[model samples]
Target chain A: MARMSTPPRGRPGRPVDPEIDSRVLSAALEVYSEVGWAGFTMNAVARRGGVGKAALYRRWPTRQDLFAAAINSLRTSGPVEITGSLYRDLTQTANRLINRFLGPHGMASIRALVDAKIYPDELGEALDYVRQSTIIGGRKIVLAAVDSGELPPDVSPSLIMDALAGTLVHRILLIPDTRRAQLAANPEPLVAQVVDLVLRGVGWQGTVSTRRTESGSGEPRTASEG
Target chain B: MARMSTPPRGRPGRPVDPEIDSRVLSAALEVYSEVGWAGFTMNAVARRGGVGKAALYRRWPTRQDLFAAAINSLRTSGPVEITGSLYRDLTQTANRLINRFLGPHGMASIRALVDAKIYPDELGEALDYVRQSTIIGGRKIVLAAVDSGELPPDVSPSLIMDALAGTLVHRILLIPDTRRAQLAANPEPLVAQVVDLVLRGVGWQGTVSTRRTESGSGEPRTASEG
Candidate 1:
């Protein structure tokens, strides 16, 4: 939990255990992903995590609070590190996104995104944390590339990042279950393919050697055909 | 709803009302969008559409059947007319996708996508229909463009379509509700910017006049600055 260490305001002596918070929050994401906002309840989360209802509520008073914390917690867990090169940075980021989306809590993410959009009046803030997870890091990479002369100044970070994220997601959405195992095993090639295309699209001119996928050319990334 | 006329296998004599099926399916999408798979109950859909549970169950025996049918029904509802010219066709299709994503049931579509990804056993086929609605038409346009000398023969349609879709969806996901009206009102400019960048990336060489967004340069498409 993002606030596991910081005790609740004006309330003293609440036991602060990172283990319980971590366990509960992880369970929160699992529950949210499985049941979504509609079916999300403190009892369900507590039951799933095997924590007491009091412990769950002590951390997050409401279901929405718990849901948002789970999403925001993404910032702390499994972050996609950013080095400088546009090609390498984007490839790394896309690889992380592909792997995460193919992970267990991916459904909760979808539900959160949908809930945020459909019920913006209620769930809009949920998207803020979600955006922070990838959009913030992605925009920084694009901006840094521009500053480093890899990309032009006139380009919109929104446009470039969207293109990258959009393509990755579209590929995920379109590929069937039959190909899923192969994709999960080899996200590098597909990530590289998308990054290269977007970099080319946005007019990035990197040296041939630093290009992404070819670096991960080991394993059954089979048929560098395209 | 996608098949109102066809009788159930070996189970006939059930009254067929296209009107009810349409209303019910429409409601199903709306309900599903608002409350995803977990909260998606036939009773909720029946109540939302004002149709009895018996009517819904009779037409479609299961929730998944109703859900899948609703997604597939998109094929008949909004056929993005595919004339020639890759640039024009993609812009039109992007425009439709943007508008639809901004529309009421867009959340449902997002849920369906996430559900399909997270629970392939349960929802993978939902994506097939979603892909057919956009991917099939997009590919046909790209293929036609390639054959007509507008694009190089070697360009992967998957790369191109993913670029287009990924960009649009990413934009939608990133923007807050505040700008949604402006985007929905004039998806043309944003659509054009994406199409132009992608087309340039893929090396499509259509003349300037045939470019998409400039045609919608009317009203506050504001400062055609991009």
Candidate 2:
């Protein structure tokens, strides 16, 4: 029995501890939010995570490696399964996207990532991975809608992704005081309006769900006129 | 006896020498492009401009002041005259935008500006001014279309601005080898498509002028179906 002690490395499922990995990653984000990318270091991350420097080093050989792993950990469950019409799916996804941006971490994290791109190669690679992974789930939902004929087949993924995310990011970066409550207050109506606008632009044949009123004049919106 | 002497400020309506100021600004952009914002200095700019350091100091009090001056010198023009239709006006403007980006200074200046924002307060202020100036003309063109019943009045101006400019920026930033040629190659069709998409989203009542296909699918589009 004394001779039967097995090393942790030899076990099939013990390659890396998922729980410790998540802790390390979250700690990295915490440090980033405090000191920004320039100030972030592997040593600071280890201190934040309450892990030994050696353990942190064993997992992530470089700062970018740690950052990219941290980003992967932040990614939530996929496909935004809201069952209904195309409008419903788009509206739900848009709301989720806005909410995620408005969360506790907020847009500073994103700005930090963009700022990081100005430096060495690892940061660029890590930022790209973070950006792409963040967008991939939303894209999957849009693609799913297209497959079901909820959206036009020829509509571009790139255009939609850029427009929606870019507009949100612009708001976050320029206006420092915006809060999650403000963002979520009436997102449904705006989301509904945008979804209709985009669906129509993409050449979908459907009833325009959100009728818009003229600016200043606030003209009455009547779908029957069109 | 009073000695008749031209004031040290120089001739009226030409108080300062344009040649030196212009030279300094141009040289600053050159240095910024090569060494980036962190390395750019007033002394280096003065040397590049072939002006005495004292003259440069006399004009610009600080690095920020010089950077702001240089950014302010960049030219931006027009609420491009509408061509009786949204399609023509939008496509014409898009082409002009592409030309500005692809021209002599082109993308390097933009990259410098983007990099600048990460560091200094002066750069941030300069960026704000530049961003506002760049979008003003475009906004006016879109507003004109709205007045002409080409787009819905309810569309958020800021959101629209972000979408148009941000889409272009995102493409340039994310894609490794994106070129102005790639954008301008079939500028007319792409612009027309985006215009139609925007118009439809905004609840504009107009005839679809072109039969453009969706990106992945080759099917010709008809407004009636949309």
Candidate 3:
């Protein structure tokens, strides 16, 4: 908290190796997603990534730094694109949210959100980006829909985002690890159900054709398609 | 997994002390919820509860056993009672879900669900009760509603349950600890918004009077009441 500015990455270490850095970053996420912050330790990351304690410490001085860097590394994937059509935009957003949670470090994000409640002071700046964005990430989607008159001006964007993210998280939490692969293989059905329900729940006035075009199935599919 | 039937409580040890047993159980939930399973240890529980290792082990021989006992202790509150009306039933259900998650042992339950994925075999039968119930708990509500023709016959109960549970969990996960008291002070507003949105989304054909009776507010308040 005392530091006024963000420190340069790999500052203390003697010019870090990209190969080792990449390995350590992946290892950090894997460890976090598996054991959570309570069980997260430098030793575990070192042992898992096959790197020495000294190397791991030098490259990233603190546990928070290492975890933050690992989280920031995922920044390349970027935010959900705002694709004009409210129905498609949410479907794509829901898909992105679900796919991300099921991704390699997806479990880490889910665990982090819960852990943040327990350990409020633990996360550093870079790590805070995902935590902060995830809650308000759908603001853009809501704004676009409201401006375009697809959704009511009074709709709570957070509710819609949570309904999507939380439903997927709940679904994922319920699915046994053994079946995750099968769900991952066919995410469309899950996405379809969630997106369609959310759209109707929020009273989206978007075109009917555009709504079903992306959503593979919903209760009204046969009637609408006919 | 190999057990033929549920084992008796205090089976391994001689009769246990109710005083120490209660302390140890509470301590186990605190430790698990605070640090999760990764950092969960008998020593921590012993220290937190101010009980000796010998006393802690006498009642619950294994870590899983101790944690299972701690989780099972919460069964005293019993399941959510089913009210006949769909609107009131869901509203009550949502409140119960939110209130439980906000309770002392609530965090432990949430954390355990995620950890179950990482350590599936670690959960003993007793502990598995909460996890199984949470996913399928709202079936009774759906059955009653469908029977009464309040909800469409084909409405997916799991979806409704997940949406309510997941949305509230998502909301709780976002609120900072500092603001939890403010949110907890009055949960009625949150319940109203979520229930109303979900009711509309699911195409509830229930009478307007009953739907808004429990829900304090929604966007359609003016038009409906008029």
Q: Over the stretch A163-206, how does candidate 1's per-residue lDDT look in tens digits? A: 87788877777777788789888788888778777887788866
Measured over all alpha carbons after superposition, the RMSD of each candidate to the real structure, in angstroms, is 8.7, 12.7, 8.1
- 2 or 3, greater by TM-score: 3
Whole-structure CA lDDT of model 2: 0.56
Candidate 3: the clashing residue pairs are none
The candidate that achieves the highest DockQ relative to the unseen native structure: 1
Candidate 1's DockQ is 0.56
TM-score of chain B of each: 0.81, 0.67, 0.81
Query: Which parts of model 3 are misplaced by more than 4 Å?
Result: A1-16, A124-127, A208-226, B1-16, B124-127, B208-226
Candidate 1, backbone clash total: 3
Q: Which portions of model 1 miss their true places by more than 4 Å?
A: A1-15, A77-82, A208-226, B1-15, B77-80, B208-226
Tens digits of per-residue lDDT for model 3 on A89-180?
A: 77777777787778887777767777777777885344446645665558887887898788999999988988888888887877656678
How accurate locally, in lDDT, is each candidate? 0.71, 0.56, 0.73
Name the better of 2 and 3 by lDDT: 3
Candidate 2 lDDT over residue span A1-226, tens digit each:
2221221122123328888977887888777654455566899999999999988878877676666666544545444553434555566666766666566444334534444434535456555555555456457656755765667777777666655554455444443232435645755654554565566666665443422222443454232200
Docking class of 2: incorrect
